[model samples]
Each structure stands twice: as structure tokens, then as C-alpha cells.
Target chain A: MNSLKQMLPEVAPPSREALLEGRGRLVAEARDEAASAGRSRLLKRRINPWTALTAGLVAGTLGVGAALAVQIGGDHRPPERVRLVSAAEVLSRASAVAGADGAARHGRYFHYRWQEISLPDEKSRHVLGSGESWVPAGGNGRGLQRMQPCTEGNAPDCDVVLNYKDGATDREGFTGPRSPKYLRDLATDPDALLARIRRTAKGDGTADDRAWREITDLITESVGTEPKLRAALFAAAAKIPGVVADMNTKDAIGRPGIAISRPGRSPQQIIFDRGYRLIGDRTLAVGKGGPEPGTVLSAYVLVNEDVVDRLPAPRPGLVR
Target chain B: MTLPPALEVRDDANELDMISHVNEQVATDDEIVTWSLRDPEVFATLYDRHAPAIHRYIARRLGPDLADDLMAETFLLAFRQRARYDTARTDARPWLYGIATNLIGRHRRAEGRFWRAIARSGTDAATESLAERAADRVSAQMSLPALTAALARLSKSQRDVLLLTAEAGLSPVEIADALGVPKGTVHSRLGRARRKMREALGGIDPLDPREDAIDE
Candidate 1:
């Protein structure tokens, strides 16, 4: 039925500007991560001068950050207050409210209606772009998508589709390409879990920065673990060596929250609300176009999330 | 889209910034992956080269928001698995589509609803409204509910083959590759799908319930 072809219009590419802006961040991250495979290869062949030098530099970076944090606090371990509180302190406090209830539902899903606002870091005449979507709880299974491409000069153009994340348990992350089942099987001791996660962590950073970023992945997007696991995840985060506190930050939703950031060439910020719940994150994108490099490339604020039996569709009025 | 003061924070301690200039070289996706093993920076080149299409493909199936989110996941997973990429397969598009399809399959119900909604209305209001090119828009409009309804009636496997062929412009071999099925299986599924579609559209009353039961 060619008639059906007409109904299923040709899918459009995202606006040229939106593609460039968003894709810029992904490319940069890929570049950084891709190098890890080679780095590990070098690490395997111990005693190479360059490898030794790189190792020394990484160790030096972590060593300095941890030394300073510990020096400021003195001889007090867990249950002992980390006087230099950061994400660890906030996460530890939040974990107390933890429970083992998974995100599964009884003939229901965690439905979310969301909007994406894409802003450019360059002055390339790319107007801001915004799009909306409605997703089912998990892959309810079946259908087609008609992606409408938004181009420059056509401000309102955008595509929409439906999603339920296909019921991924641990959600998706770089921590060893494992599933939520992996998290479910993790030890209750946050330290043991952190060690296991560290094995999967990439980057040329200290143990702390690597672990901190991994923790950020867990609480932010993935189907957050059970309460006890979440608590373990946060307590584990506290132990990351270089995590620094940033009490003055807000989520993409503009809600105030405590932020824990790991310093690097491109620092990543993870935000949590006063209630200790995860909210959102921001990354400093240093692209070629902007006058100054550090632009907030991509970020999202969790506006609302709830468990409902029926897939939630935004009222016709809210459809952008 | 400047950030509010509270949402924007920076670290002066990060003095060693990545070189803003990326010396990009034209290379096959395989070469890029190979180079990435030597220099991670090369992965960004692959990202810049391909993520837009990947994003659109996902957006078409799931919508923009999830497209944005899943696009990131797709790349990260791709990055982790780069070592396993078959160098002979220079074009990464099929592989990327496969990754996206698996992700889409996860939310099969949402996709079904999206397709049904368009089918019921016989049009997508949002796209139709701004599709300045009236001629192209008109053809894609007019009547599509029958197609969507028939699509919904097909088993998920059959429907996937049809969409990959129709929507993604993939060949039978690519569809087989993307779905991890044999080429023969892809052809069979597509053949059955086309037959059912022909019956649905060719018949006077596509909406008839009796017609839908013939395939099963």
C-alpha cells in the first residue's frame, strides 16, 4: 500500500543546528572514551616510558585531591563525619530513606511526558529548538515512528515518538555494559560495589573521579536501584577521592540542589535536591564555535515522575 | 540559551582543557574506531559523523525527548563495544540502527500506541501543520489509518522487517544484519508482511475484523 507510505511520511533529520549542537557533545565524549581502549592496552605492557609517565600523572592527580580532603578532616572513618562534605555526605543522608522497591509495576508503567529544549553555544544563527515526547513505562512492544525534521528558519519543526525504555533493569550506562540484574546482584557494602564499578570506569582520572562519574550515571537516568542499593550507591559515592561540594546549583528544572562535581578538562556536575533525591546534571562543553569554550552543551531536569497503570498522554493542549 | 547563575558552575582547577581544535581527517568509521584505540579523541569524529541520523531514526520511533536520551546511550554503548566492531564493515549505519532498534523494541507498546494514534486520525497534526511543502505533505496525509491498523495487527517481527525496509530504506540483507536474523528469514517475514498489507489495502473494507484473522 503506497497509500500507507503517504501516511507514514518521510522521516526528517533533526534541525541542522540541533544536530550539530547536540552531536558535538557526543563526539567529544566518544573521543575521550575511545582512547581508553588503547590506554588499557598500554597498561598491560608494563614499564613503557609513556605508560609509566601517564600512570604517574594520574596517580599524582588523585593523590593530591585525596590528600587534601583527608588532611582537612583528620582520623575519622565512616560514621565519622567527612568534615569536607561533598556528594558523599549528601548521598549518605539521602540513602537513609532508601527502600528495595524496584520500578516494576502491576500492569502499569512509570509514564513520563517530557520536553527537550536545545540551545546553541555558537552564534551561528541557529535559533533555540524545543521538542516534546510521551513515553510508556517499558517497551510495551510494537509500532512505527514518523520523525519530522526541524531545519533552520523553521522554528517549530520537530519530531515526536513513543518509548518505554524496553524494560532495561539497570538502565543504560558505561559501567561495564551490564544490566540492572548486575546491580541487583551487587553486594550491600557500598565499598565492594564501588570497587567492582571502578573496574568498568574509563577515563585518565583518579579512582575518585572515575567512581564519582559512574555513581552519577546510576542515580540520574537508569531505573534507579532498590532503596538499599541506592543507599549503597550514594555511600559508595562519598568514598570517591576528589568529589568536591557545590551547594549552589540547580537542576535543569531550575530547582535548587546540592551538586557534586569532579574537576577535569570538562567537568561534570550531578545535582540532588534538598530532600537528597537525584534531580539532574550539566556538562561544560568546550566546542569550537563559541568565543569562550565552556557552554552547557546538554542537560535535563526531571520535572515529574510517577507510577501509573495507563500510559500517560499529555492533554492535546500540551502537545507541542 | 544561557544558563541561570545557579545552574552554571565551573572549576578553575581544570586548567588542562582539551584542545578546542580537533584535527579531523577523512576516514572510514572503522579507521575512526581504530584511531580511537590510539587516541580517544577520534571517537568524537565518529559521533559527529553519524549521531544525527541515529538520533532521527530513534526520534521517528520514540519521539525527540527519548531520541535525545537514547542517542547518548547508543553512542556510549557503541563506544564500549568499539573493540568488537568488525573492521570489514566500514559503514557503521547498520550497526547503529541495530542498536537503536533493540532500544526501540524495549518500548514496543509506546510505539504501537504512537502508530495507532496516527492511524486513527489518518494524519499527524503536528507534522502536517508545519510541513510547508504542501504537495509532499498532502500525499503522506489523506489516508493512513488502514495502514497503521494493519501494521498493528501484524506480529512484531513482521512489522519490524516492513518498517526497516520502508522507513529505514534497508535492504533485506541489512535488515537481517540489523535484526540478527538470517537473510532468508528477513525475506520470508517481509514477504508475509507485504502480502498481509496488500490484502488490507486492496480489500474494500480494510477495517473488517475477519480479514485481520487470516494471517494468524
Candidate 2:
């Protein structure tokens, strides 16, 4: 068996330059941790309210700038022209696109990948993270979720395994009893779906707010799966009171898109590309006891997705 | 034993440097991991000591290009999971190898492609120099495809156990600790892997296969 070690060609250890480059990542993490610690100290004490507000603005500006840099560096495509349109118009466009997309959704597994940036609170470091999942389409079966904390310089395929099991749908953000199959079974009529979403949507805020949240959740989940369901979800969202569309908006990843949002302190906005494709979503920190107004508290951009015939290995007997 | 004035000064500086180096060297990996919880910066010491070996191991498994990214990822992941690391085990090599192995598992397709490419072409991205490839191919031409084909045939678990033993040079017990599998599972997997390799190599024992094809 000793010969097996030598079966492969001799490989040089990483060059000094490569080693340093890799080490730089660890060093940056350390630096971020230290900054997070400092932020924690700042949050714990009572300071002059005006000074606190000023510090928040400065920190928020710097954090948003760094995030924007990451987005710009990763995506080089010219910005799409964003036109301020009525909420009804944006939803209509999205509905038409979804209806016209005749691609059949018939695969054993649905794989979703997205990049997320979140500033959990005032103290914690704003983290850029990404996640991916491979789930069985219809029923309870084996699934895998991979997540990783990413840096501006490097965002590789996730290494952190968040879940691997029969009911990974719950972890994939399809709240209680909501799986891909469940979404597929939902009403396709816009009004009927809106009624069902209002009933199913739970948690804080008014009925419209909760329903809006549910609509976005379904939109994110069913984007690559059920086109008819997606069309209904968008059209349903359009009916929510105070829903508005910002013509000029860019996702956390700096992809220009039309942002459809409802007025709220922490408003969740979904950004769509020119073709009305769901590109990304973000929650803004507006008004008061958080980061400065217009700061994105959390955001995620869809990286890629596919209907894989079979998930990658980890299947015991299914090797090549 | 008299030294020149410049040499004496350099010797004095080296002696002073050794004192600080010795202080750092005294802290075990466990201690550093614990210290890093508070300081965070101390985690770099672990990266400095172990990353080269980890990087090379990955390079062997999945060519050099991917190895760089995965190697960096392994340490970052280790740092993130350091709090959960069982410090009872003083040596972090098994733990680090375990992380590296998991990352390699994700790239199973790329690895399969790498092996299949070699089986078909007798060379891959890792086959560095033309002269080395030419010389190695002469002796290995008959067995190269067989070896690679055999590797591609092994189940992911069997391959992980086998490579942890052969590539990272971990004992079965350490392999168990690294993989979170029982020692019995490791032995059986290793046995099965060796048996597959033997059958592929014209009934020659993989436990003691001929060295004709091996360069190192």
C-alpha cells in the first residue's frame, strides 16, 4: 500500500507566494473578529445619542461601501436599465415572463445556490455568506445543504454542511409542512393564491406584511421549479397595499434591477432583472435604532440553480 | 572557536530569536486553539504550521489549481469550527485531514474527471514536467490506466479511508478519529479498497504492489 502513496505524480508544496496568499485569508478573518469585538464594546455602553448616531452613519457607510466593492468585483456586466414603474406594472411583467417560460420542471433534485450578506445587529460584523442546497423534488428524501462564510476576495462553493437528511425542505426555508411538492400543489389563480398565502403566512406585522413575506419566500423557493406558481406569487404580491417599485435599485451583488418593496421600517425588497427574473432580495434598515437609513441589513442574490438529475456523491453505493 | 565581529553579532541576534521561537513552540496545538478563542490571531500559528502539508495532500488528490482554493477553505473552516474541536486530542493533524477530506468529497466529480483523464491520456494537469511524464509513462503505461480506473471505482467512503492511510499517512485509529468512523469500519473499508486495487492490478497485491510505476 506504500506504493499507492507514490502512484500519483510528485506534487510540490504550495509556493511561498501561495502560502502567504492563503494565510492572508486567515489574517483577514482575525482582523474582522477583532473589529467585531470592538463593535460589541461600542454597543454595550451608554454614549451620547448624537455621537452614537454619527458613529452608526460612518460605520454603515463604510460597511455598505465594502459590500458594494465585493459585488462590483464579482459581477462585471454593465448595469441593466432600471425604470421606475408602478408595482402593478412590475408584477405584470414578472407574471408574463413566468408564464412564457415553458421550461418543464421535472427533475429528481432541485439545486439552489445564492449569496447572502447580513448585518445581524449593530455589534456583529457584517458577514458575506453563501449557501447551496440539493433537495428531492416531491417528497421526503435525502437532501444536502452547504453554506459558507465568504470574503469579498473569495466566495468558493460552500464547505459548511448545514443539513443532510430526509426533511431538509424545512431547513431550505419552506416553513412548516411547506416543501417543493407543497408549493407545486398551491393554487395557481393569483387571487386564490393570495388568500391562501395570507392564511398560511404567520408571525409579526399586519396581514399584508406577513402575506408579502410569504410571497417572497415562495418566490425564492419556487423560482426554478413551478413557473405557474411563481407567476401567481408575483401577481399576488402586487395586490398588497403600499407595495411600490423603485426603478433604480441594485442588489447586494451590484446587479442593477427594479426593486419592488412595500413601505416599512425594515422593508424587504425583491430585485428583478430586465427580463423580470428574480435576481436578489434585501431588507433595508430604515428609521431609528439600527444602522443608518437605507443600509441593507440583510440581502441575498441568486447565484445559480438547476434541476440536477442526481445529487453529487455522498451516496454510499452510487460511485462511478 | 573565535568568531569575526560581524558573525558574533549575527550569532547573538539568532540566540535572542531562538528564545522567542522556543516560547511559541512550547504551546501545543490545543493551547493555541484555546488561546485563539480570545485573541483570534493565534489561529494563524496553526495555519502556518500545518497548511503546507494539507495543501500538498489536496493537490495530490485533486490537482493543484483546485487545491489552492480548497486548502485555504480548509483552514478557514477549521478556524470557524475550532470551538467545537475536542482539545483532548493534542494533535490537530487528524482533525485538519478530516476537514480536508470532506472538502475533497465535495469535488468528487472533478476528482473522477481527473482520474478518468489520466486513464485515457496517461497525463493530467498534475503531470508537471515533460521529462518526468515521459520517464514515468514508460514504466507506468501498462498500470496507469488500471490504477486510475480502480481509484474511480472505489466508493467515496472506501477511497477516503484508503487515501487517509496512504496519502496522509494516518494510522487506522487516527483515521477513525479524523473521519468520525469506528476503527473497524476503517479497517474493513481499507481492506476492501486494497482488494479492489489488487484485482485491478492483474491480481498483484496492492499491499505490496510492484514499484516499477512509482517515481517517489
Candidate 3:
């Protein structure tokens, strides 16, 4: 049984002549796009507003988990920026505070409460979802997760709870949302931690984006309990290429914070409070297709985190 | 402080090094795309980086004769549509492959003919390259006809997913991104396509899991 990749006949790469010709065509296209800047603006004006909005909404739905979004319109304007802080400075400050902020506390479970916004393509309405989870701190006991999706007028009927009887253990090399055992096993040195993240991260996008996503996932799930790990994670994130910080952004819940963003169309921005605590993260739609350049396609805010002895039952009136 | 010729050459080398270092500040694909907004010539960097692979992909599908123009067309279309590129994707391979695949879609009959020609005659434009793989060539010789017939029979979408996996070496996720389809669709289509290929090849499995994992 031959692999398709092997069975397929091998073809030569483009010849030098072909390469030059293709490059020439690309250059020509680029010049034309630049030359027609005015025409593009007029074309943009001619685009139906309703059609553009529909495209954006459709893109938003696809953008939810896949991180792939649409860009519409022709305005090639980059987003405005005032670089008040560098990403290194922000991460350094966060790392400094992380290790000293709180004393070590013992508890049976680590509890986290967060709110996430998702856009289901068909409905095209923002679905606000909340989740609460309690993982056994020792990594060998029952774990509970309660999730609910709510909208403006409809709520209270969709609460769902999941239980992991043998503790919530992440896959051995998984980088996203890990358990205490996984966090403890991670390298504390910044360079090594980043290498490990690169090795294990399974997300889409560039390598740097995947590394940053893994660090953010750790911050969201386990870092609140392990201050030392949180510091290391922040340090690791500071090393990702093309990371920049803006001191004027706000999280999903309107809390002002500094944002560290990767370079991309709808780049994910991680928000940190002035005191250097991770508050939330959001994806900004900066390119043409979907929403306006500054629209937040999806976002998550950490409301509370603590070490609890017992997993509290779902909030009164919220879950049956 | 006049020095020997060797020292002067070293000084000149240092000056050149400094200039090249300044020029070599690498930029991500997204950054290049953004910069191309102001200086369109910057778009040529993307072509230099990806044109060979894109050209080869087109050649394998539609034969080397049309690869020259289609590859240029692919980049031209991408350049025109640069504004719509989801900047969120830092690596432009999927997006470029998508554009190339769309362009390839237009020459569907040409591609079918390409496969049929291979099925009819075991030799292909790539046979010269395949000559090195003597062992694989034996099996490929036996399977090429059946494989081409299977590929010709598959639906456009299924073949797209399968070839993106087999030829472009794109992961399932990347295929989804390139085609603007769901990841699940890539998975299902690839499964069906491979199963058909296996049946066509008398259950030899054109793609053996042990060789390479498709889900990756």
C-alpha cells in the first residue's frame, strides 16, 4: 500500500524563467492595485451595504473557533495605533507581579468562571456563553463543568453539566487548557517553556500564533492557581516574534487593560489589567471582509477564579 | 591607520554586512501584505517565496504546459484580492493554495484529460523525476492507470480535498481554510475519496495510514 504522496509522480519546481515571469505578473498586479486606489474607493462605495454586512456576519460565524474570517471592502487602511507600551515591558511587569501577588493556598479543586461570545453562522446573532469548571487540584478526582448559552431575551433553559470521573487530565502533549498535573510538568524556564509550547500546540495559524495561543490557554485555565507557572507563561509569551502591546484596549467586560497582539488580519489580542493580571482576550477584525476593522469577532473574559474545596452547584435559578 | 589589502577587504565586507542586515529584517506574510498596501512591489516577495510550490501544484494537476500561465494567474488573483485576505492567518500557504485550487477548478476538463493521458500511457511529464525511485516506480506503474481512472471518477469537491492532501501536502484544517469549507467536510470528503481509491486499486489503499496520517 503506497501513500498517495509517494504514489503521485514527482514534478520539478518552477523553472527560473517561469519564476521571473510569475513574479513579473505579481508586480504588475500590485502596481495596478496601487494605481487604481481611487477607482477601488469608488468601487467600494458601489458595493451594496446590505451585502457587505451579510458577508461579514457569515464570516464571523466561521471565525468563531476556526479563527478563519472573511475580509470585505477595498480600503487598505491599517488600523490606527499609539504604541504606549512594548510587549516585552508588559510581559515583564506581569511576570514580576505574578510570582508575588498571592500566597500559596490549598484546596481540593480549582474553579474558574468565564464568559465567552460565539457567533453561530445561521443565526448570525452573538451567542453569549458562560462556563464554570472545577478541576481536582491533585489531578485524580471528579471534575465538573457547567456551561450555558444565553441571549438577550432567552436564557435559563440551556444549562449543561459534564463530569469527568477520573479527573480532568489533558492529553500528554496538549498545550491548550491543561490540568494541574500538565502545568506542573511544563518547563519553568522561558525558552524551554516556549519550545515545549511549540512542540505541543495543535492550533492553526503561524507558529508564533500557536505558541501564544498555548500560553494564553494556560493563563486562562491553570495559571491563576499556579502563580509560578503564570510568570513563566508570560515570560514565554514575551519571546514570540511580532508581538506588540497597546496600553489603551479594553476586555470584553469593559475593563481597561493593555493588549498584546500578534500580527494578522483578525489577530488575537490578550488583555491584561494595569496590575498585570490577565483579564481576557479578543480577536480584532482588522481587514476588509467581515465587520468593520475594529469589530470584536469573539472574546472571552475571566470573571473569577479561586481554589475551592467543593464544586458549588450551579447558580440558583440558572440551572435545574 | 592604513592597513593591508586583507584588512581593507574585511572593512568592505563589514560595510556590506551592515547594509544587508538592515535590509534583511524579516517580515511575516501578513506584514508583507499590509506593507504591499503602500508599496505594492512588496507583494513580489510572496511570489518569490511561494511561486515554485504553487507552480508545481498546478503542473501536477493540469500538466506542465499550462502551469506557467495558471501560476501567474493565481498570484494575480491573490494580489487583486489582497485586501480581502484574512490577516489573521500569518502563513499565506493555505490562502495561496486556495487561490491556486480555485484557478485549477476552471480547467477541470484539462485535469481530467491529464489523468486520462496518464492512464492511457504510463509515462508522464514527471517520469524523468520518477526514474530515481525505481522501487516505487514499479508499483506506480501498476497503479497509475487505476489511480487516474479513480481520480477522474471522483467528484470535484472530493478530488479537491484528496489532492490537496496528496499533492499540496496541506493538513485537513488548511484544506478547510483554503476551500472556505468546514474542517469536517475536508475530513469526510478525504475519507470517501481515499476509500474509492482503495477500491479502485483492489484494496491496496492508495493512502496507507502507516505511511502518513491524514488527520494531521
Please state the error at residue A46 of candidate 1 in Å.
Answer: 6.7
Q: B1-216, model 1: which lDDT tens digit per residue?
A: 111111112222221122222221235676666545544544654665567678767766666666777777777777778777767777777777788788888888977886677677765432424223323443332345666677877877887787777656678888887889999999999888878877776642322234323223
Residue B158 miss distance in model 1 (angstroms): 1.5
- Rank order (by DockQ, best first): 3, 2, 1
Please give the RMSD to the true structure for each candidate, in Å.
Answer: 24.0, 24.0, 24.0
Weakest lDDT window of 10 consecutive positions for candidate 3 chain A: A65-74
Candidates 1 and 2, the one with greater lDDT: 2
Clashes of each: 23, 1, 7
Model 3, docking class = incorrect
Candidate 2: where is the Cα deviation over 4 Å? A41-320, B1-25, B130-142, B207-216
lDDT of each: 0.55, 0.67, 0.66
Best by DockQ: 3
Ranking by TM-score: 3, 2, 1
Cα distance off (Å), candidate 3, residue A32:
3.5
**Poorly placed runs, candidate 3 (over 4 Å):** A35-320, B1-25, B130-141, B212-216
| Strongest candidate by lDDT | 2
> Candidate 3 on A181-294: residue-level lDDT in tens?
566667468888899889988867777778877777776665335677778888888888767765445565656566776645225667787556787777666566775544
TM-score versus the correct structure, for each prediction: 0.40, 0.43, 0.43
lDDT of 3 by residue, B166-196 (tens): 7788899999999999999999998999898
**The TM-score obtained by chain A of candidate 1 when compared with the true chain A:** 0.51
